[model samples]
Target: MSKDPDLELVKRFKEEGSLESFRALYERYKDKVFSTAFAICGNYAEAADVSQETFFLIYRKIKRFSFKSRFSTWVYRLTVNVAVEKRRSRKEFLALSEIGEEVFEHTGDTPLETLERTERDALLNRSLRHLSPKLRTVIVLRYFQGLSYEEISSILGISMGTVKSRLFRAHRELSPLLQRPPFSAPPGGQEDAWQGN
Candidate 1:
């Protein structure tokens, strides 16, 4: 297949009902779609279902594609939307009560090191989970998927400024989660107390 052949295949499929064209498009984008879905859904089974649903929707709606953007970007946007909707629907069944506070406990040699690492990772995850879906999506697309801001804007159907704003907000929200422990005292306090000078 040629570069951007999926777009041509989709165009052909819409015009001629060509199964070959559809198969080619599927082969080209299957992994990308599945990977995007899996990144958001975080489960192989749900990701598989989301991937199938995404392609099914694409097939039904292929005629509506106007070629205003890359087909891959359009498909990725669909995948993200589908994954987010699935997550929202499942949220009610999966309560947040199970998120235990014992995450700081250490289980290996060098307890302090283990504790620090675990706590840091947990705090990051918790902060990410607290972000709005829009902010989280941008962070995931830019950082986890390594997409450029333009690509992310295309995928999300938003202006570049919106992408920048959401990423800035995500980072701003995460900063406190990564800052110094709230109860830590100044360095000189303990030294002054011991010296009594």
Candidate 2:
């Protein structure tokens, strides 16, 4: 078998009725699909459901898949669509949860370091949630998933220039969010710690 035996297996599944080949392909891409889902959904349980739904769609639609793009790209597009739909449905629920009062508290480093890091991460996530879904998708795909611009454009079925423009705009939006008040000090700002000297 070649390096990506799953590709061959997918072909076989399409040509013949090979359940084993289909299962092989499913196993090969499940983790990547799940990770993509979790990155968008931010909840492990929902991600798992989305991952399963993604594969189910793949199996049903595999016959319609053209080989014009890589299999991974096709799978990623499906996963993203499912995640986006789920997010849309739960928008009201998320908004309600956001309204709950939670005081901003930071623990120092050491065992405290982890807590501080967690708080910072939560803050960043909250900021990201404010961005439009399109902008958020571009940020997640580029930064978290580490996909190339070309890959993102292909998966999104958009022009490369559009992807670049969205990324630039997303950074512009995120910069101000990162620089506001408490987070203004930047990641490791000694000056902020010793202010009012």
Candidate 3:
């Protein structure tokens, strides 16, 4: 028996053509797919479109999903590929400013603190917007998705060294922009600290 928690569901969907299994998978990954799409495409509407299309493609291709990689990794790769293609075809891209609302939530704070936090969030969003897609992808996968370097390399189909280099570049670019103490990696288990949810 495969140790992958989702393997049984995937097998049911792939072999028995079970819609229930597929729906289960969809429920599990919808938010992740949408977030990755939004992070890459940088537009809510476009991300929604990408998410829908990604699921459609997954439904069609699940039969071909080899067990060589984790199902989640394969899904992320599909999402990233779709988002990148969509981005490349478009003439302009928007900054994912909505990310600030989703990521940073300061409740029960003084008005002054709230304002300062908002400004900081805005600065971070703008800084992220300035990074190239390649660099931004590394940042999103590492910090936003809380993926490991090995997982990122697998998802992006890049070498571990390449993933590290891109992350280094992204951090360097964002640091000056987020000045006031400069941007740094979040502590372990706090990967979602930026994400107030």
Candidate maximizing lDDT: 3
On residues 1-197, what C-alpha lDDT tens digit does candidate 2 reach at each position?
A: 12443567778888896899888888888877876776677666777899999999988998988677778778889999999899888844232012111222344558677666665665566567556778888888888778889889998889999999999998988887666653344335645321212
lDDT of each: 0.71, 0.73, 0.83
Candidate 1 or 2, higher TM-score? 2
Q: Which residue pairs in candidate 2 have backbone atoms (N, alpha carbon, C) closer than 3 angstroms, thus clashing?
A: 109-113
Lowest-sum lDDT 10-residue window in model 2: 95-104
In model 3, pairs of residues that clash are: none
Q: Scored by Cα lDDT, where does model 2 land?
A: 0.73
Model 2 residue 102 distance off true place after TM-score fit, in angstroms: 23
Q: Predictions ranked by TM-score, top down? A: 3, 2, 1
TM-score of 3: 0.82
- Give the Cα error of residue 160 in candidate 3, in Å: 0.3
Residue-wise lDDT of candidate 1 within 45-90, one digit each (tens)? 7778999999998899888988777787788889899988998888
Clashes of each: 0, 1, 0
Off by over 4 Å in 1: 1-5, 93-130, 173-197
